[model samples]
Target: MPASSHRPSPASPLEDDNLLPQILLRLPPDPSSLPRASLACTRWRDHVANPGFRRRFRLHHRRNPPLLGFFDGCGSLDFHPTLEAPERFSLKRDEGDGVRRPLGCRHGLVLLLVPKPLQVIVWDPVTGDQHRLDVPQGLTMNECYESVINGAVLRAAAGDAEHFKVVMVAADGDGVENRRAVACVYSSETGAWGGFVTAPIPYDADAHASGLFWRFSTSIYIDHAMLAGDSLYWQLIGNFEGILQFDLERQSLSVMSVPVPIYSKGNCFKLMRAEGGGGIGFLLMSNSDYIAQLWRRKTDSDGVA
Candidate 1:
């Protein structure tokens, strides 16, 4: 026989099968890369789609967390505290455009609502992504409409241990009959604005009274929330005195009160759940400085006086 004929025959199909599992086990976890490898063949996709493979992919995404971009000056970027631990970002008028007042932020996005007529810009704090969302169309149509302003908050929720919610409130244009206040929520998981909720303004007196409670309340809001297994606990300043909790799952409201000093009319800032006894603290700005006042659970030492 010729020397070339001495080559061994190809390995049985079983040998090819044995090699596949090994290749799948080693595929790169980057979601961008995994999708491409999956296109190579049916077997590749099967392996890439494995639950174990997906878990690893998720882990990688978790590690390379996206950065939230924000603006300090009109054209400049603000970088402090990083995105992980947020520090309060301030807002001022754009001077040139009287319409865009730098409003506070909620989720990674900040709101800039034009004072009178109503124009709004939702800008991301990390990427500086800007989205111009219109005020609820229904509110604009009414001829009786008058003043308007937007309020926002930002936070990140942990597991069941804590729930974080960002509330976007609109001080409706007061009509002779009602103060048509509206509240909408932007959730991290669903990444969409929640349905518009209507609440009758408790005080019919004037615009000044609408935000009275916000002056002294201490509230915590999440800048982002996870889906699949995330939890959100939120409280709403239903009028000045009635506090309400919004359960994300049931999409319903429950009545609750933020402790006296905790929700009092003040600079309303910074909140974290307490340890052991589990209370909440409200930070207030006095004169020109800020202070932390902790409100703990009332002990049996004395019943409600």
Candidate 2:
């Protein structure tokens, strides 16, 4: 055999055993790239698809995360979270023929409410897996315009498969100028829409009688809720004193007072998981300045923050 014939082909950095993790760590945060990268070769595919690799990839990105994407009422918006140039791509629909807009986005899943028949679709943009959920019975076709609907998507467990819960709050005006309203919830695991757990939203009685409540109701509808711990916190549009709280575990409803008053739009408040582990926390941003205040619910304190 000729000596030249015995020489090996050019070495690929990917072929280096010690450099495998380093190579994988540099991959884009988008899940769409996983399948294509796996197809590079059998060994590469297995390593890329490995459970541990996926977990580590998630952690790495969490620390130095890329811009996966974001959404608005119009449609899904994709932009790089970091300074890197944004990747160009279009979102694919697993089902439905007509146009559907995003109603809620969380836990990497976009909850889309389709018009015409009024259906709820939970889509995992990463896995391309989708679930067409049943709309709440209380949400009637005719009453749609008269009601306020708020929804949130929650992952049942972290780092798990398609297990999730979709909660919807349909509040209908009592015709008393928005001082009174009714609401309901729908759960995916139980496959049922729960009953109406109504509550009276705080209103300025003196101002309400003067028709101020009616005018305020036009702009100050209850919407944009946040999920933390076992409760969902909904901000009152015009009211800065309190927030509507729904306990998912108890299926009960109550009103919670804010630590400080806020008059700006509801975007100033947010609910997030506690970093120390367990419970939830509230992030209230100051309107006058760039400062943000965080209040955490104590695990043993029974809803006290």
Candidate 3:
């Protein structure tokens, strides 16, 4: 210790301003703990709130949870506590039930399907805000068939909460040989439905049953979509066995096959959005072997995963 007679030693490097952020970056990935750490001081709060810090924090964790929230695959909506994501909060529906099911979820918004007159509701589980838009008219209203078709949420732009788009690949008719599909887009900004974009179905739609019991198991939409850049990917029905990609920017549709050669019965496949590279990844899990295989897309290559 020194009292003016002698010079005090320089403060430790830990006390330096630069060292604070480096310490905060080491915070556990559990987002619930971050606010508690921020309570320590305003400086800690600033560090924790930084966007860069949040990105780095996600990458730091080895086994970061994949699901933010999920559709219960039945006719209800709830959060999975074990797989809960602190960044995106859970929602509770107040509307009296009359066949409400989760259609799609993306970018903090969830698409829900409600029948009787046929409608799709866009909901933000975090803020408890929602916008309801009627499904396009002149299309097939078979609730059993429509629920299985693919739908997706497209953000208007990153960090723009006021606008987003809800798109659906709906069935034009339920014919057997030449099944046709139509796409409808709903813009939150315009608050109206867009014109239907039509296309030819590759495979037979009648191969799968169309009943309430079959509705849960089968659909033209194989699984929830994987968003990469401006495109959204959805796995196809069993007969087709491929992925349907919709380019939000171009407003076009293209089909691609699964990486596997022969589609096995009861095999599980998932399309995932790459964490860092902004590319896409496909996860395959076959019942034959319990091993899970993950393949990432190669941007430079012409056709590789």
Candidate lDDT (C-alpha), each: 0.45, 0.60, 0.64
Off by over 4 Å in 2: 1-33, 43-67, 76-89, 92-101, 139-142, 177-187, 206-223, 238-241, 257-261, 264-305
lDDT of 1 at 34: 65
Please, what are the lDDT tens digits per residue for candidate 2 over residues 1-305? Answer: 76665668877865675577668877877665677788889877888888778767766665454456555444444434333444443456545435665666776677776654666777766666678876666553236642356667777655544467776654445443554434566556676767777666655444333232234452223345566667877655432245667787787766555555444433366656656865556687866677888877664557445
Better of 1 and 2 by lDDT: 2
**What TM-score does structure 2 among the candidates reach?**
0.63
The runs of at least 3 residues in candidate 3 whose Cα sits more than 4 Å from the true structure, single-residue gaps closed, are: 1-73, 81-96, 139-145, 171-174, 204-219, 259-262, 274-277, 296-305
lDDT, candidate 1, at 264: 42
TM match of model 3 to true structure = 0.63
**For residues 169-254, could you state the per-residue lDDT of candidate 1 as single tens digits?**
44344333344445566654455567766544344233234345443322222212112112223333423433333344555433
Cα lDDT tens digits, model 3, 1-305, are 76667788987855755787777767665546677888997778887788776655545553443345455655656555444444545455546646676766766578887764466778866446777777776554454345656677767876554578988875444543444556677788888877766656566344344211212222355466678888877766544456667778888776665556324554667888766777667777878778788877665556644
Query: Which residue pairs come into collision in candidate 2?
Result: 67-81
Question: How accurate locally is residue 283 in candidate 3, as Cα lDDT from 0 to 100?
Answer: 79
Sort by lDDT, top down from the best: 3, 2, 1
Of the two candidates 2 and 3, the one with more favorable lDDT, higher being better, is: 3
Report the poorest 10 consecutive residues by lDDT, candidate 2.
Answer: 211-220
